[model samples]
Target: MIRKIGVLSISLLCLAAITSCEKDFSEVGTNVVNNDKFETGEILLDVEITPKNIESVQADNINASISDYWLGVYNNPNAEKIEASIISQLGYISNLNNKDTDTTVFNLDKVILKIPYQATSTGTTDGVTRFKLDSILGNPDVATSIQVLENETYLNTLNPSDPSKRNTFFSDDEYLGDNVLSEGGIYQLKPKATDTTFIFDRVDRSSSLTGTTTYKDTIRAINSQKLKVPFLAIPLDITKMKTLFWDKFHSGEFLSKEAFDDYFRGIKIVATGSDGLLIPLNLASSPAPSVDFHYTISEVDGTTVKDTLQKKYSFPLAGVRNSHYKMTPATNSAPANNFVVQGTAGKMAKVKILGLDLSKSELTQQFKGDFNDNLNDYDIDDNGFLSLDELQKLFNYRKNILKSNSYLLMNDASLTFYINQAINNDSNIIPQQLFLYQNKENETGGISPTQLTDAYVDPTSFGGTLKKTDDNPEKYTFRITDYISKLLSGEENTTTDPLILKVYNPTDSPVNNNVLTTSVKSYNWNPRSVTLFNGNESANGTKRAVLKISYSKEK
Candidate 1:
């Protein structure tokens, strides 16, 4: 009886397998499988941000070598009314010749101070080329009053208190007193035609074949072309030039460069107007900014002219070029809970990360608050309580986690700032990028802004470029993985300094020796403004600024 029962069971099993193969397979158990068992998730946290009005920035040592000096007055509706000026010292004339030892009489024809405009040729029309000034901020049609004043203050290259460091000058320095040398009158951003046409010498090369004899003929011709290059031609006072420079031609003051610098300090170019534009003047360009002394020298022997010659002595504007800025804060024009960001001694925003310094108990409470419903799912010990030690073991993973037994890792940490579209709708005036830095206390108990360590590690990944949707700038995103990781891992100070958000200045150094650094000297020449939503929950709601961090943790 037992053998018969075993054979019957084997036959039934074979029949069942054969019947199932004949029919179509069914997905009845597919829904029972857990697809999200090992999936990772992210946590979004809100960050606090506030507006900070900048009074001034270090503007000394901002010469032609590092960056172009700005000059003019501009009224920004969002931030401040800025008036930019330049104070520059003239370089000395090397190798002075004693030609005036004889009876040589010097007669000043005219003294002119020329500052070439940064212009580009648009097109040639009717034998004349049209040009437009480059890097002109605000309305170019408005006229401004320009004045060149004698700077009585001596500009030192090194700090008087500490010779090791370079001298620092703020934007609000009063370098020009009542010493007006040349009042340049009302001036607009228009190209000025030359008073006289320039004569150009051209050579034409032509080849002619006649009776198997080749003849190459070269003809030299003179062509007249009226050249027009945009520049500021301020007619300086000839009498003043004679007294300041010409009279001391062969005197002891001209014997040394330092002596001449002490005698004639420098010139300050100031701009004043109700409505005007700001322009960047390139003092290092060809035919740089200079005071040209055009004169004629006649060798007079008892009123009998022996020899006569026309000459020009150009005193180039060089050495210790500083920018002075006077800013009047704008009225409260931005929307409620909106902050402003501007360049060139403007304003910035201060940022603080929430819950960045929580204790173990506080962190456990926050974790519970963030994942109250899923706390039981993550509690692997099968206990009703979830401890901080277990959560750390589960989520605290190093950047290189292959060597450790950690079960979770942070992938990215970023801050997204939404633009206030009502105030910052104009794309032309919006800043192309933004920068995030931290202010470190200096030796003198002063704070200085410096770049984050992530920027130095990889600038491409540490993004601050403007993000747009449908070709319209909508927001700016910054990747701060290293910085956030350090804070989480207790590598950095728990009481972290507030990060500063400002308009990106291209001249600021992004990296040095594989470490991030920033320029303490003033180099932000851009005059643009942008308004962003401050992280005020009562005002902005969901659109308020927040720190979004994506991570991968065990389920």
Candidate 2:
């Protein structure tokens, strides 16, 4: 009898060899796993303390040690949106008093649902917590009731399919069936009138770098064929664009598109991804040329300064290089087309431009030369050509600077989505919205971004300390690479999550190297993560450019 009792002990029960009738998975059937196999994940909303209610846990110890409950993400179509808003609002939720009641908190235009999911060491998890999705106004407010559970079910099946295995990015779109497929998913987007358009909220890669156009009436043949333009966001309005600065001609409202023909014309407003890739912005019809504006760089310095040689990886190369060139950050308010100097004598330059047609003669002449003080005053005439007086000034600049035709056309310029995969990586590689977002004030909730000045480790943040359970990371590694590269190439007819990272080299000036970067970094992930939002990762290797990814499902 004593031996039989010992066999049934809670600790020894699983190993007891008594019943042949028991299922092989009985061990896992009894507990929620803390690994990457499940799609559903969970987060502990109240990290303060265990309630006087749950007796088994060190409620007081756990609660007392937590500054605020750190959140994990899963099953969210918009983590970037949520993360930014959380950072700004400092989403601090607490049931300090453990009230059963609720109240409205903050209202915002960009608050998405607060799903219950997060990745942990053992597996993705959730605390038996629930909160209302949102208020009638779309923004969430109020502290609501929560049910913190030590155990919850995680049932998410992840299909680590290959991109090369499929015919196109869309074969699995409608077939994905509740899996929450994203850009890096097996499925591609299909064209539809309802497809959302994106606006270039910001493009750090966008430059005032333009070569003179050699316009010919022959080139004026309009592209009558309708195009599907996608933007990073949605319908662009003058209100949102007004925030960016473009060089003013000291002119009027100029609302009438008809009056803007002479020097700048035949340009259309199309949607682009946050990185400035042309996305399907207007589905109803293709975009048409409207108006042209001046272009300018912000910083005036002639060169990029290196902060510290050894710290290249410690700080983003984008910041270092851009800071080196004393150029300004170009904005929607800047002139639509303009030429800016990149390098001084004996030095190379990094100049960028957008919105000018290199096919136009007026531009070609201006760009064909080394544009400088002498290049200025190139008079513009109707029908688009230099006033001839300006041609003389350009004659000198073009001679010295433009030796190798000194001009290259960015005809291939268009919006594209980009992706980089790692054996281990974080979802923060997804482009987050910096313009509009907010946090929830309540403790009990759905998806709310959790802020951290010293944020917890993510796939990108993870050093070599974590284990290598990179099963899922390996699966998505290849797909994510193709997924992002395709987006950067502007491939259409595929479904993508709203989240994307707007990347660019911080150099407002020109770079000696072609790799452009941005401060924003994030990624799209495997659907199985029910609770993990983004991974705690940090890129590694002797070359800072070498990317590395890692994760911690638990302590």
Candidate 3:
């Protein structure tokens, strides 16, 4: 039946049909008004990362003022032989009580070299004895010994700025003095605690009948305990050192500091014998690391000695130390999913992020953009401005405007590192903490001399110690949310530098750049853990380093 419909009824039918339409109107019609309110949603972006080899770095080029520098020797079974030595300048020693050690008055007793161990208290019963060593790598079961020799090398005499003269000293150089102060094998090395005693008063507070506390008889008890410290006490020969001191004293030549250093060159500490023990010693202790000279000027009344004058002289000194490492390529029995991470002066593990092409088309495939690849199609620019045409690209699968004039916010971003436990399972050799840095590779493919990042994430919030999980025992995670945000926020550029990893040194660093230019680096050595790469099929399939990022867009 043909029925006549009113104009209002036809308009109502057209409105209903347009509301039910599911096709995207923005593509077909240019004047379509998108009044849909913006909504918020989250997304996860995946980044592929791979590990690469890093070059060896000079250990001596570091800040010298701080005591964070290392001094020791360790021979790695699969890698290089590590050795270190210190050179110091002696301070002026005036005659004590107007008495000089010349032709008549003073008599020498003995000279002792005291080297303190790197130790810390764990709030345990033994206190200092229960303290743990900071950087005691390798097995401690084997026997090891240290030797002390007079260093005849004159460092200040050479030009200070010349790298070859001031910084190029090595382990094989013949820069030692003829006289050996303390021979090796003097102290047998072990990782056991020493006995210590403490006294404390016992206080008893109990409730009385009136609900008040009452004091009982107080008693002092002595608590004897032991702590583990890596200390070395080397006694120097009095006959040899005494002769050297007398020569300048009798000639009335208390010479200048430079002449004094040249006359009695600093001591060189050499470690040998056991391959297991190469521990770092603290050279910046409170008493100021030194050599103590014990003497007695005795006055005899009869055949028996009546007045025995006991006196001790200390030579306080401070100087730079040098580390020598003979690193051999790591020896792997079977191929694994990990690569090595080592550092010292400037050593690092270089890594490359894979499967990411920054081209617009590739970004579109991953991001699924609706616009064209050119500037006319894309909405965002280097200045972070977005056009209305760009806002249309954020439509959801339901063809709803999910985003408006808004910006993307990073919720979480992290880099996960998997350790090859099969190859590196030694507990002693594990790196305690790891650090992330910019690659800063120069034109010659080498890292710059001073390449530390000016910007750093909060240590408590980001990259730190490795985490142990039942599923992935050797996993290390780094929080890169702030770092990635900087890149997206136009604070940093990816084209300028890549990423690298190093061992984290816990010591407080000196802020002065001049000190870093001259001192030697002791800590931050090879951590032996390698990063797993993509496309490399292992027993457990392809294990790759991954950057997992979570972001949200506000409507």
Taking the tens digit of each residue's C-alpha lDDT, what string does model 2 give over 160-198?
Answer: 264333111110111111221112222121222222232
**Cα-based TM-score, every candidate:** 0.74, 0.15, 0.64
In order, what lDDT does every prediction score?
A: 0.64, 0.19, 0.46
Q: What is the lDDT of residue 219 in candidate 3?
A: 15
Whole-model lDDT, model 3: 0.46
Ranking by lDDT: 1, 3, 2
Give the Cα error of residue 289 in candidate 1, in Å.
1.4
TM-score of candidate 2 relative to the true fold: 0.15
Worst 10 residues of 2 by lDDT: 315-324
Off by over 4 Å in 2: 1-116, 119-138, 141-172, 176-379, 382-555
The window of 10 residues in a row where model 1 has the poorest summed lDDT is: 1-10
Backbone clashes per model, in order?
0, 143, 11
Instruction: Quickly count the clashes in candidate 1.
Output: 0
